[model samples]
Target chain A: MSVQPQTQARTRRTWLRVFLIIPFIVLLYPPFYNSNDPTFIGMPFLYWFPLLWILLTAILTGALYFLGA
Target chain B: MFTFNPVAFTVFIIFFLIVTGMGFIAARWRRGDLDQINEWGLAGRRFGTTVTWFLLGGDLYTAYTFIAVPAAMFGLGVLNGWFAVPYTILVYPIIFILMPKFWSVCKQRGYVTAADFVKDRFGSRTLAFAIALTGIIATLPYIALQMFGIQVSLAALGIPLSVSIGGLQIELPLLIAFLILAAYTYTSGLRAPAMIAMVKDIMIFIVLIALLIVLPAKLGGFGAIFAAVAKKHAASPTTFFEFLSPKQNWAFVSLALGSALALFLYPHSLTGVLSSNSKNVVKRNTALLPIYSLMLGLLALTGYMAIAAGIKPPKSLGANYAMPLLINAQFPPWFAGFAFAAISIGALVPAAVMSIAAANLFTRNIYKEYISPNASERAESTVAKWASFVLKFGAVLFIIYIPTAQVINFQLLGGIWILQTLPAVFLGLYTNWFNRWALLIGWFVAEVLGTILFSAAGLKSVYAISIFGVSFPAMYTAFSMIILNLILAIVLTPIFNVIGLGRGRDITVATDYDAEEVLPVEAGREALG
Candidate 1:
């Protein structure tokens, strides 16, 4: 099941590269989004921002995977 | 409130029996020769994307996450609790990068455990032994926590705890539950959990979606839930809703980052990763497993719902009972039974995986390394199978004898110890410049200092310390210890090399870890690296 070298190089170019960076940005700086105001569906910003990123991160990961990275 | 409801118990038993039947049938499902260590321990390295997803999801998100994440919120708000959301989130990216390398390398070598890979990579048996011992010891308390999860469900169901038998009091239900787990795990090995996880995860998803949708409407919505929680915090100023205080900022960040780093270092997490058929299966699963993380976040919100609904645990079971009690209070009896069944079976899937992973460590790293170098593959399989039985039964006994709070504290302490391996196993994957003995010394220093700090803080599960009498507000001990560990390894490596000490030979090359897929079964079987 070894990938052809040409195919492997193309996989290396895929957006899967960004999979790790998005998390480091969202999770490392909690103070930026840590508040109970500006509520979404009656949930706090502090709570919902992290929850929202859960979906966004998943989408990012899936996009990268499909892009062949 | 605590009366025995036969309806809940009957539904619980019904689901329990179905899981048991699944367990027995799993041995022959995708049938393999059980005599080899590969078939017995790694599920023949044949889990594709779907099976790997369910297995990893089912294994990583266990009963403890179901019961305790919410309980952490119900009892103490942000610092102790909400870190779980980010902890779960950060784990995937970390696993995405690190675990595929692990899978490729382990596959190339026929290495069954992380310790087996470590043993070959650095050409150091002692270092591999350290890693294996750490894996076993670190996992035991976690397995014990799963048993505690079962105990919580039974307590809610009002199962008789101490039924006198043969002139001795025993936790009869807990004993019976573990015996069933041990039997199937012994007979079927990793396959039992792989099969049962599919059922456990679906049941949990159904329960969570139903409960989350209905509970918020029943309690008048998320705003009211948080309002009730805020009211409770205002009533008791010192305990709840510490997010505004900013005192716990370090604690929150460190707890999340530290645990995310520690998650995949665990033997069982590696067990799940190594069981997959290829690197792509693992990489794809990393993308999809976050669905479970989303479920975990919603489930953690249910803790506040327990508060808003005015559900209180009986004094004996304490706050951990918050989730189970809330289920019984809000749901009808049969649904509560299915919920409890979900929790009970959730505990089993991971428990089976942990024991199998730990047993493989024993068989490969310890038993084969020293006990009998030429031990047949059959002997290795036999050793791992019995070791799984004894190891899990021991975990069951550990929880029964110890207090649940202490078991939790002990598990936190286990996290501190396991993170010490970062320099040895995790870093060694990228580079082996550090002397093996330096890594060992770093691990020892971190273990001792982490323990002393944990003990110094009045045995608090999480603590921050005063260095040179400058007190820091609370931070996680594991994160602190890992920093000290990394520094020690960095500092001591060149110092050891300057003296007469020597670095071990690196037998593995970089390309070995870039293998595209696992070799054919016969080819992989023939090479005994």
Candidate 2:
């Protein structure tokens, strides 16, 4: 979890940063997940989709954190 | 005074006292000098992963989020309420990308405020002053709203917010609460809130978990709750939509994006970030802090739960009372008291941190930079402490004197105003290519035009503009204005350069943005001083 001090050259994994944009693209467009036809445990798609994304996005961010992007 | 439960009142008072006691004791928790601005304002930047997580969760989620998100769902349904879920989800990835660099640059320069980094990066005192002024003004109504959150909780508890003594009206209860808050904040600075944030967050989480489990069971289940929400929306098609209509789609997207972008730009959020010990701490917390967002999403559903419970808030308290009333209806008096204390204590943590953040801006960018160029570190810290007191007191008076609707309107505009700083603060992190004067011009134009647009939209944050008889769908005012702000800065930079306007010197080196800790070069500046 500690940043490496001896790594002089800055980690410019700018390509890895693209993974960060996935949640924004997925979650921002309500049209993509706005339907209620799909229900999870009685919650409609509209409701459950974003709630599920919260966990997914957290994992996405956690992955990014681990990759040191 | 509609339903005074003495048990709830006593329980609320007891928990309030516990946090107040903890607030005072926090000064010694990680003990730093009380007379240095960095030490006092940022807890000497020693917060590790877990502490920073709680501090930020408590800071960003806020009492406003606790009350208003559910309140919006209860009152206005999806567009108004559910957008917050996506907004919170989107913010962390943003923090994951942006804040580590911001923390790195600030640490390397000993920058106490974002405006401090802007001033150095752009080398424009006027631009820096613009940023400092905006941060302070934008946060003022926000702090007032935290007081409003406490007022709503007390009202729900049937406690008198004000009292008459000798024919003089006094907000005695709120005054007493704020005085206790002010005392500890003055004595302990950011440490008070950092310590208390741990308590506030745990209590909030417990309340959230209890409500999520207990309420759904009482009201059938999530299926039944959504059925109730859908039924209500069907009953009032004009007011509430169970899903985003085609036209409302862009507005929701923009609102979510705009607010997510604006959340961390607020000085208080950055105060939480800057207080952390390292970029890794900030990065780690971004991943962890979404736990609050998950809580917020469930909390927003409580508004739907209120609908399911058939709860109606009194006309005086309005929708904000829905969550508290739902609690009172479903939980016992003692639990209601604990929930109310969780909320009011929730309000106190952000209020303290925001005032400290705003005070830091004024001291570093305005007072020390302009009013007294030769201010000693002790003198600077002293000014910040007093400034924090004055700002909090001012907000208390603002809540007591002003209409809550007016405060809400200003807070809406505050969001728009703060995002205008992004060109200088957020974009300034990666590159210093933009001319200083160009960035200032961009900020000025965006702020003025944004306010005008907000007014044009009847002070709503969403507006649909028709240009040349071709109408565009409504979008978030902050989102639209930020685009304009960015375009203006980008177009003007080369123009300003070619016209022979000089750019300010950047004091930071490229590696500063990737540095793991405060650079020795910054320490050298302090030594020279």
Which structure among the candidates has the greatest lDDT?
Answer: 2
State residue B425's C-alpha deviation in candidate 1, in Å: 1.7
DockQ of the two-chain complex in candidate 1: 0.63
Q: Write the per-residue lDDT of candidate 2 for residues B94-119, one digit (tens) a residue.
A: 88889989999898889999999999
Off by over 4 Å in 2: A1-12, B517-529
Candidate 2: which pairs clash?
A: none
Candidate 1 local lDDT, B330-423, one digit each (tens): 9999999999999999999999999999999999999999999999999999999999998998898899889887777787887888888888
Best candidate per DockQ, number?
2
Global lDDT of each model? 0.86, 0.89
DockQ of each: 0.63, 0.77
